[model samples]
Target: MSRRWSLRGKEIAVDDEDVVPAGLPERLFATDRFPCERINMYSTIDFLLCVRDALNGTEEMAMLLRSCFGTLFRFPVRRVLMGKVIHGMLTRQVLTKKKYELWPVFGGNPFRFSLVEFGEVTGLPCDEFEEGYSIDYELPATEENYAYWERLIGPDRDATIADLVAMVLGDTGMPASRKLRLCLIIIVDGVLVPTSQIQKPSLKHVNLVKNIKNFLAFQWGRESFAWAIRTMKPCPKKLRQKTLRILGFPLALQLVAFELIPHMQG
Candidate 1:
């Protein structure tokens, strides 16, 4: 049977019950429950299906998210109506590789997801972010969204985010994680900023940035994103002449959420 549930204002028709089905897809259909999850699984399997070593057959990645991403929410999974549109699930502590909150009181980027630690949280100001990056109020405020997303990933259970992620995505070799880290390299020229000090970008980062729009356009495979990237050239100038483009916070958050699948496959 099909049922309609309004998830964060978007009307979604869920098939069968809300239980995230037990396995990755043999093939994709219109009725997949977790839309983004379904597509990611499909893409991963489809792209790397033939390569045996590339994937961890029985212990696949999504399976890991299912097993390790425990139920922190109090309500029964079945009892819940619309799934909470977690605003900063990517930026929240549990999702972080470091397993703790480093939120800046001055309102940091709530969606900044990384395999390891955040560059820095809020309140403590840094010169690098103020000079280098820019903020997009475009991504919705995550304060209200945090209630539903509270401890969704269980940050404190004595497992490294990488280990659990490897357990979840079944990436025993951990290639994707490495690739993700590489992509996350901020290309700043001659600034000599220490890796230890990172800051929140307010739409303009100093030194340099990544060609995030182009990267995201390829990753999401959405025309709208490509259109927006092509049409919008908000921050054009960079300190260095040879850099590609600046990576935006929103896309960086997405990279954390999706991990290195797109980087590996695409």
Candidate 2:
């Protein structure tokens, strides 16, 4: 016999022997519960697009970026759809020990997204790489790293995403190589694996891109997928807050949803 269950007012049929996951909530949050006024999700699409435009007519610089970023530089930004998918996934989230799962509101089987899927969807490199290349791997605090940070940012304070955008867009007479490095950092810290600090570009990212070849070889897909998973993990304090701030790459999640759920394209 099958039993009907209501989750946030949506009814679905379940087997009599089916049991809810141990840590899952009895009632999922309503799909409409996300408040537009309170949610602060940031995107760097405009900044990146402007940078792309600025590089127009410069064949050499453009080719360099294409070689490094692949399709990530061309990732389309659909703000509305991204928000909807992110909210839906968060509301319907199912927590597990290893990874997180999302139960589609449209009544499909729960699914888990991993680095492999992320790489497939984004066309980023996902192969195993050296530990030093990993996003989470902190570089040693050396004078060279400090000098690089100072050259890009400043001597006094940490630079924010807004600051990077200005430098990339403005004609500060920066070299093509330096600008290219900055652009990659903007993509990673500003868009792909953003944190709650208003998408502040990490100094580590700045250091990683110093060697353009090595930076391009890094497994960005794996690191980004891991960051996104970490961001979506259940948090009691976050759930209680009125202003919800989501970290990581919600845009990637939206893209994956479009591929997996064909109906979402409509």
Candidate 3:
């Protein structure tokens, strides 16, 4: 049996055979000094800084490219696929309902752009689900369609999205959570449409991953802080202050805590 990481209560086997030198994963995530513990904070800040510097002409495209490579270092390709499926559904479902109107919300805004990106996420045409729903056989599957679909679906879509959304929402069966977050992130950040969307092998997939990583990291920190500030009702009088002081409060962390604690309490 291989060592594995348990994600959303599922055991995913680790392919690498290298033996850990005892307590590595725990130490990496648990310790303050270990890079993984604070990697999100610094990496997120650095990712933003790189973009800023690029826009300011202080950093050239070559330098930004190098930074981008480093920023994505060790990012789980599987997670990206999961996110793609979650967003893909939101896009396809809404588009099917109304070709011109973006569902979950109607606006010519950044959130709306995310729905448009659904096509890129699944590597299927925006009309796939609609065609399926209508039982239309007008669209033929080309070699490119098969290839892209293979890449997008990988092992599965619905199953993977189910797990990923559960992790993000702390819900047993909340289908709307991931889509809601994607819309909120786009609206809050007001991300511009990438020029690469027009090119072959569109950048929508690439940027989608980056956007999700940033949004999750930021939310994690935010929620952590909110958890600290909000007092627990019916707490022990003797330990109330101490409990508040020790909370790992950050804004991102608060959002995560809000999502998780309800499930935990239940």
Candidate 4:
């Protein structure tokens, strides 16, 4: 028997023969170092909390973040379980050609983690963009782009995640617009679509945020979800004996676990 599954607007047939056993024992044995290191959202959440406190008695905070990142602003920061999230990553099985679905065994039962589940859990945008719409394409790389980059990172070097955090927390003298831009940078780089090299922030993201309105309207959920799936793609042979670094927002996975598993809600 075959079942029809819809993922990210595409439909496919999943046959019983095609549903392979997780075969996790063999994969786990092949890799001695399955320690998963993922980018945490704590710093971003903390910064937002601080911003909230600072904007008490005013609607500026809402005006700044609500329109663009309403879902993220409402994210249950305290409920994230890193241990459970890492366990899910370690046992994840890539079961589809689209690579957007993961089936991870927990307590001897498999749970589905797919784009649809991720969007539902995190409230992130998951609709496929219309043709010719690109999320990663930044404004033209000109003097204007460099000027914004310089303002954020300075003229001498690329800005690291540490640098962005420092700006978000310490750079109080900056104008509200600049400060909002900086916060967006940190949130996107530090929490949403981070790479293993957590220090080096992407200039593409910086340039994209140059126009705040466009940045806010862009479908970040789709981009972030795609990055997470790409990072989670299994490559046991190449990753043997080395730490596995997970990219994208792992907090979503933790939240999903909390919802699906009763005991984990605590």
Top model by lDDT, which number? 2
Per-residue alpha-carbon lDDT of candidate 3 for residues 152-177, written as tens digits (9 for 90 to 100):
32333222322322333343243433
Clashes of 3: 22
lDDT by residue for model 1 over 1-266, one digit each (tens)?
66543312345565463323444222211222222210000011111121222333434333322321111111122321111212222112211122222211112222222212121210111223224323231334345433222223232323232333333345445455332221122111001111111222111211112333322222211211222222112211221123222222223223222332234213
Considering only N, C-alpha and C atoms within 3 Å, which residue pairs clash in candidate 2? none
Among these predictions, the greatest TM-score belongs to 2
Backbone clashes in candidate 1 total: 21
Ranking by lDDT: 2, 4, 3, 1
After best superposition, candidate 1 residue 117: deviation in angstroms?
Answer: 35
The better candidate by lDDT, 2 or 3, is 2
lDDT of 4 by residue, 1-266 (tens): 77654433356666675555656333332233454443333223454465554444445567755664666777667665564465545545433454576666556555567787787766666777768866455556577667768876778555676676666567667667776776677667776777645445667888878888777776678878777766566555533424455667666766666666768666
Model 2, span 163-236: residue lDDT tens: 77788778658787777777778778887677655777676777777787887787777667666666655464
Evaluated against the true structure, the overall lDDT of model 1 is 0.23
Between candidates 3 and 4, the one scoring higher on TM-score is: 4
Candidate number that wins on lDDT, 1 or 3: 3
Off by over 4 Å in 4: 1-60, 92-98, 130-144, 238-240
Please estimate how well model 3 matches the true structure, expressed as its whole-model Cα lDDT.
0.26
Off by over 4 Å in 1: 1-55, 58-143, 155-219, 223-242, 246-266
**Model 4 alpha-carbon miss at residue 33, Å:** 13
By summed lDDT, the worst window of 10 consecutive residues in model 1 runs over 37-46
What's the C-alpha lDDT at position 44 in model 2? 50
